[model samples]
Target: MSNRNIQLAVLDMAGTTVADGGLVLRAFDIAATAAGIETEGPERDRARRYVLDTMGQSKIAVFRALLGDEDRAQQGNLAFEAAYDALIDEVGVTPIPGAAQAIDALRTAGVKVTLTTGFSRGTQDRLLNALGWNDIADLTLAPSQAGRGRPYPDMVLTALLRLRIDAVDQVAVLGDTTSDIGSGLAAGARIVAGTLTGAHDKDQLRAAGATHVLPSVGEFAELILASRI
Candidate 1:
């Protein structure tokens, strides 16, 4: 069995630490349609599934998976970005309930905090700046920075290296998607599932190999404290 005393906490953005109300999916739908993918019925459902399955993956990987061809993939990615930027202009995103507080608490407890996401560096920076989180993050990494994406453990390993941590077993990863859990599991870290972000329900998270599924990050804070005590 692995130790319960975690020294590092790696978090996934989007559905895990932030609440954006399916903004990414909406953007992909619009972009896919613009790319001549025909977003209707089975195709639409397929696209949605593809997006969900590729949540923690790099944007390039997502595009490649969905569009297949390099040219079409590039076009689809550009369209997605344009669509996402437009959506952001109309609707701003916020940190999920207790998300900031959870990070703060973890830091106070001497736990290193790192954020891992599949967003492009430019796009991720814009979102964080808009949320007024320009300085709160201890360590932030995007797909561009990691050089690899989720379900592969590259992002998590990068975060671990940045924190100068040596034991993968001493890390805990929190996310709301299956890819997030899979990445954590792949990295040999304890996985905590956050259901309040609406990425998936508790059952889905558990099925993805999460050690525990808490309602929100706030509840997760309480649990972490209790475990320490």
Candidate 2:
């Protein structure tokens, strides 16, 4: 049983639990080029850097920042989704080692787990379908289900509400990026953990307000179950 008061675990999908093998960046290049970001140059380079920097944010939101115009942003988002889905079909997605077992352990410990992502609902579903994770968690959320995505606290808050969590203090959130940390912090979750399996480093996660940093999602169950907090 868990020693911590954490009742809900809001986990990020990609990088944190799912390993896409750099498919995100690969898909971004294809979509950006199609959306007129240029095949290669300073503009493409800057946009690519932005995508890296903003890992864990909603895809549409990222495209909005990159493309500026709403129409262009929507187009780019669609293109990104298409490209990402195609890649998934071509190469498939895999779970980070021990991720599924970790989640099962958490659930067995009486913690409600909700998988979350900045990807669109369709893409999120595709990932779940690809991994055969359709019933893996108590719930799964995408940015569309919530009003906003990471760095805004919407998805985390939505999970808390939908899961009937007593309070933000009773929640533990984990992910592999600073944006994930930021969302958890903003939602007032007591434990906001950053894992090293994805983008960003320890310093970056801490700077973004992570409460703890773990090596990967495989270690998250122990941190929560053994918690004395």
Give per-residue CA lDDT, model 1, range 1-229, as digits (tens).
5355777888877877888698998888888887788758887789888887667677878889877899988888888888877787789888987889998999899788888787778778777887788776789888778777887788888888888776887787888778888888888886555554756777778888888888777876666666773
Off by over 4 Å in 1: 1-4, 192-194
- The count of backbone overlaps in candidate 2 is 0
On lDDT, the leading prediction is 2
lDDT against the true structure, each candidate: 0.79, 0.92
Candidate 2, 121: how far from true, in Å? 0.1
* lDDT score for candidate 2 against the true structure: 0.92
Write the residue-wise lDDT of candidate 2 on 1-229 in tens digits. 3334989999999999999689999999988987889888899999999999999999999999999899989888999999999999999899999999999999999899999999999999999999999999999999999999999899989988998888888899999998999899999999999999888899999898898999988788888888735
Off by over 4 Å in 2: 1-4
